[model samples]
Target: MQFREIIRQALYSLGANRLRSALTVMGVAVGVFSIIGVMTALEAVNKSVETGLTSLGANTFQIQKYPATVFGSGHRRNQYINRQDITYPQALVFRKTMEGKASTIGFMLSSQANQAKYADRTTNPDVVLTGGDENFSASNGYPIEKGRNLTTNDIRYATNAAVIGSELAATLFTQGENPLNHSIRVGGEVYRVSGIFAKKGAAFGQSQDNFLLIPITRYLNHVKESGSINITVEASSRKTYSRTLDHAVGSMRITRGLTIREPNDFEIRTNESLIDSFRDIERAISTGAFIISFMALLTAGVGIMNIMLVSVTERTKEIGIRKSIGAPQNSILRQFLLEALILSLAGGLIGAAAGTATGNLVALQFNLPPIFPLLWITISMAVCSAIGIGFGLFPAWKAANLNPVEALKGK
Candidate 1:
């Protein structure tokens, strides 16, 4: 038989068993979906993290009582929890001691799930509330778009002045209405808006602009819980970042009263370190997804093998007649293999489309733009093709080697 005729016959055979073909395709689809969906979602998050998690601004790092993210035994976690909190007084002392060594020093404390109100419009209670100093904007990259940032007087006097994010300003102020000097209630305390922050997008499905900043002193005096402060230190230049870190570590240890024999009680975090932490987490999840998908694909390959073996058995007489009529063994093998390849490829395409759409839905919820993982799609298709060849080889070989007389006699 001609090669074209063999391919036509293989497709015709698969088409004849609609239910079996559909089920076989579904197995491959499920396998592909498992990995593709996970990878798509992680890719979106990775993109967001590149821009969002690195908000510590250039040449800046922070010292806080606890690590940003913790994973380990209960004892390890409890050690962090039991460490003495980085206090406001301690931050001030560190600032004073590191004055000439650093370009800028700032303190910040925050709370979540607080509502902000203007007139009758009330924002969701998911608003973030922060207390910081004059250098907060410079340290964190939250530039002021209108009015002015907090001053020394605001912190010294414990003034109720506030700087709001772009989203919060929009939520509280109408068109042509000035947000400056407007009184807004946050956490049940009224404060005059002093500045408006430039627009900052979302991070990890949370709004970065849904926040209000006040002077650190005012936050400590009224808004925030005690001992929840973090100190930010900025180096004068990129070349001095390591030097600044070393100095800050030494100063913070001294300020915290830690002896040489004791390990440092505080955690120092920079933009690069934060990004590294997230990458580690992403790698772990990606590894897990890959293992799960491999197993699923393995099962799907077995299913394809079983279905192809059954196909060969059902078409035994056909194969016998073709062999008797001068059909080559290679043609029989190629036909069965093509059928398996087509089945897996079709399922992969379907699964990739469905997984991409589903994963983008997760990104959409976080206000991130849609991403089409073309690379993943290509890789998935290639993997599926490999699976088809690996599992279908045995069945194709069995079909090609069948004895014409025995097959034709239904033995």
Candidate 2:
């Protein structure tokens, strides 16, 4: 028979047993869905991380009491917690010590889930209240859109001057009123607006422009006392970044009074390091997803084999009739195999569509753009084809080699 005729016959056979074909297809779909869904979500997160996680400027790094991300055992976590806080005093000393070594040194501290109010307008209790210096804008990638940044006088005198993020400004001054020089209450303390930060957009579904920055000194005194401070340092150029980082570590060690024999207690975080860490996590998640998908697909393959075997048995009389009418063994084998291929491919296509849609939903939650994992979809389809052929071979062989006399007798 022509290939087209064989294909037509195979499809008709599957259509005749719609319920069974659908069930088998669903099994394959489940396996493909698991891998594709996970990969799509992770790809979205990776895209966001590459763009949004660069909270620091070029050739810059930060020193903090805790690492940017924490993992591992309880003991490891406790080790970080047990280390002494990077006090404001230590920050001052480090800044003074590294004055000429780096281009700019900035300090910051923060509190979260704070409310902001202006006149009759009030914002949600999700604003980030940060304490920063004049260098805060440059170091942290937030530039002033209007008004002036916090000055030395503001930090030295602990003035109640604040710079508001774009989202927060819009929330409090919705009537197009000027936000600059206006007074707003944050966490019950009032501060005059000194500047407004440019719109920074959202990351990981969270608004980056929903924060308020005040002088670091003011934050320490009013928001929280005796807490760790984060110090940001920017190297003059990429060529000097390594040297600058080395000097920063030594200067911080001296400020923290760490002897040469003692290990550094604080953490140093760079944009590259942060991205690398995230990549490691992404790899781990991908590996786990692949393993689960492999197992699920394996089970689905077994199901396809069993179903094909049953199909051959039920169609024995029909096979006998076809063979008696001069049908060849290869033709019968091809027909059976084609049915399995169609079943597997149909399931793969359905799974791919569903998985892509589901993955995009996760991206939407984070305000990330949608992604189509083409490579994964192709791989899934290929795997399904393999499953179809590998599993369907035995049944096809059995049907092709059946004795025409016994099959006709319904044996």
Candidate 3:
């Protein structure tokens, strides 16, 4: 028989049992949907994080009280207990000592989810606020869209200058009415807006464009009220990054009065380290999803096998009549196998489309753009084909090996 004839016969057989075929297809669809959706969403989110987090800069790293990628309990408490708050003098000492070795910078952060009000327009509490020096722009990568960057003179005298992000600027000021030179109340304290930052969109779940940047000296002297400080350092280049890190470690050790044998108390965070933390979390999630989807798929495969067996039983007499008349055993086998393949392929396609769409919907919650994974598509199709062949084999073999005498008696 022609391949077309085999396909035509298989399709006709499937059509005869429409409701049963549809139900089996639906079962497969549900199984495939669970896996493809989650994988796509995660991949898109990972890509978005890489792009948004690029601001951390090349060869640049930060030293803090805590590890960027922490995995266990008691970390927050240990951060305060085992670590020392980096002070202004320590930062200055590093600067004076490592002037040619590395570019040392100091900054302080005071974040409050306060309302930005201008004629009743309000913003969400996730607003970002940063306080830093003239070196902040070079160190943290804040690009100015309008007006000038904070000058050294601004920090030397503890200026009340502020740089507003694009989102915050639009929320407070009207079009053509520049926020520069205007006053914006932050935590009930008014400060002159000196510059505007370009749009930064979002990173993970955080909005990068809803921030206010001010001079660090003013922040420490006036805002903090505690007289404490946090210092940030940037390496000169990728080539000198390791040397810069060594210098900072030694310098912090000296400033903190740690002995040569004692372990370091400070933390240094790098971009690679942060990405590794993300990857570790991703690995855990992927493992769980794989186990769940695999079990569900195994159940669905069992369902397919049972349904195919029933289909062979229902068509036993018809199979014997065809075999006695010109249909070879291989032809009968091919016809039944192709029906199972059709059933699985149909289900898989529906599941893939639905899963891809659903994944993007979830990812959109974090402002990550939708992504379609071609590799995933290929893998899913191959899995569907394997399920069809694996489960459809016994049923097809039983039908092909039927006794013509018994089947003829039934007919």
Q: Highest TM-score among the candidates is held by which one?
A: 2
The residue pairs in collision within model 2 are none
Question: What lDDT does each candidate get?
Answer: 0.89, 0.90, 0.79
Candidate 3 Cα deviation (angstroms), residue 256: 3.3
How would you encode candidate 3's per-residue C-alpha lDDT over 1-411 as one tens digit per residue? Answer: 899999999999899989988988988887788788878878877877687677678867776666766666786667555666777666677677777787646565656676665555667776666777777776777788998778788888888888888999988888988778887777666678999987867777567888888887777777674433555678877888899989888887887789999987877777888788888988988888778767766776787788889988888789889888978899988988888888888888888888899888867877876778778878888998998888888899888888887877764
Position 223, candidate 1: lDDT: 72
Give the better candidate number (1 or 3) by lDDT. Answer: 1
User: What lDDT score goes with residue 225 in model 3?
Assistant: 43
Which of candidates 2 and 3 is the stronger one according to TM-score?
2
Question: For model 2, how does the per-residue alpha-carbon lDDT over 1-411 read when each residue is reduced to its tens digit?
Answer: 999999999989888889998999999998899899999999888887877766776699999999988989999999999999998888888999998899888889888999999999888899999999999898878889999999999999999999999999999997668998899998789999989999999876788899999998988888898788889999999999999999999999999889999999999999888888898898889999899888888888888888899899899999999999999999999999988888888888988999999999989987987799999999999999999999999999999999999989878
Instruction: Give the Å error, residue 122, model 3.
Output: 3.1
Q: Candidates sorted by TM-score, descending order?
A: 2, 1, 3
Total clashing residue pairs per candidate?
0, 0, 0
- Candidate 1 has which clashing residue pairs, if any? none
Query: Residue pairs in steric clash, candidate 3?
Result: none
Q: What are the RMSDs of all candidates, in order? A: 1.6, 1.4, 2.9
